[model samples]
Target: EAEVAQSPRYKITEKSQAVAFWCDPISGHATLYWYRQILGQGPELLVQFQDESVVDDSQLPKDRFSAERLKGVDSTLKIQPAELGDSAMYLCASSLVNRGDAFFGQGTRLTVV
Candidate 1:
């Protein structure tokens, strides 16, 4: 079984449209993070949640991207008016407390035309 689950393994959308990805992390993990990875580039942090509270979202595009873990069980990432630059693999990972082994989801690949 997968340690984490992500939906819609692949997605293709036109530019200026909207897209969203979902992720369910392993049970009992208290820290969750959202990352975006462009082709040939390393994953970049988008947002982080410690339980139900947001601890970091400095790199997130607040104007067009938003992430939330309301109850801390699962999380969602949404991008409105997605641009070409938003085409990337969105990854979700969870850890014990932000400093231990991280369990990564399969990821959602978004392609903006």
Candidate 2:
């Protein structure tokens, strides 16, 4: 089975620094999502995309965070001047139209000092 692609599984940075993460969803999947999980909290939707179009991004912290999906296949998330509160598990997930179960990558954990 093909695996989801992710990079820099762990990241450590000082507060007010910039950080970014990348992900590639499974081939043929139409929907992709980015979620933020804060320790004990469940993953919260940060953004959702259908193909190359963004479906929802109401929960995203537009002030410091931005995300995009290019060509509807690969995606990237960037945070400028990162804050200590931004430390968490940033998960990328995707699902096919017929499949409701989203497959998640191990996630990129960010730690800000």
Candidate 3:
């Protein structure tokens, strides 16, 4: 069975350091998304990409965070000068069609100290 792939399932970094997470969506999926889920809260969309173009990123903290889906396939999310408040589960999801049932990866848990 195909699945979204995420790396470094766990990460710990000091405040002001940089951190990055990677994801590879299931083959043939066209819609990819990045989400941040703080403990005790529902996931919040950080960015959504349809193919290689960004569709939405209103909630993303663009000053310190960024995401990209180069070639419309695998993607990477990065945070510069990571802050303690950035500690959370970063999830990657994909779907075959817009608003379809998305498959999610085992999220990368980030901890900034």
lDDT of each: 0.92, 0.92, 0.96
RMSD of 1: 1.1
> Model 1: runs farther than 4 Å from truth?
none
The TM-score between candidate 1 and the true structure equals: 0.95
The Cα error of candidate 2 at residue 6, in Å, is 1.4
Q: What would the per-residue lDDT of candidate 1 be over residues 81-110, giving only the tens digit for each residue?
A: 899889899999998874778889989999
- Candidate 2 regions with alpha-carbon error over 4 angstroms: none
Evaluated with lDDT, which candidate comes out highest? 3
Query: Taking the tens digit of each residue's C-alpha lDDT, what string does model 2 give over 1-113?
Result: 96677777999999999999999988988899999999999999999999988999999999999999978999999999899999999999999977799988889999999
Sorted on TM-score, best first, the list reads 3, 2, 1
**TM-score of each model, paired residue for residue:** 0.95, 0.95, 0.97
Return the lDDT, model 1, position 1: 54
- The alpha-carbon RMSD values of the candidates against the true structure, listed in the order shown, are 1.1, 0.9, 0.8
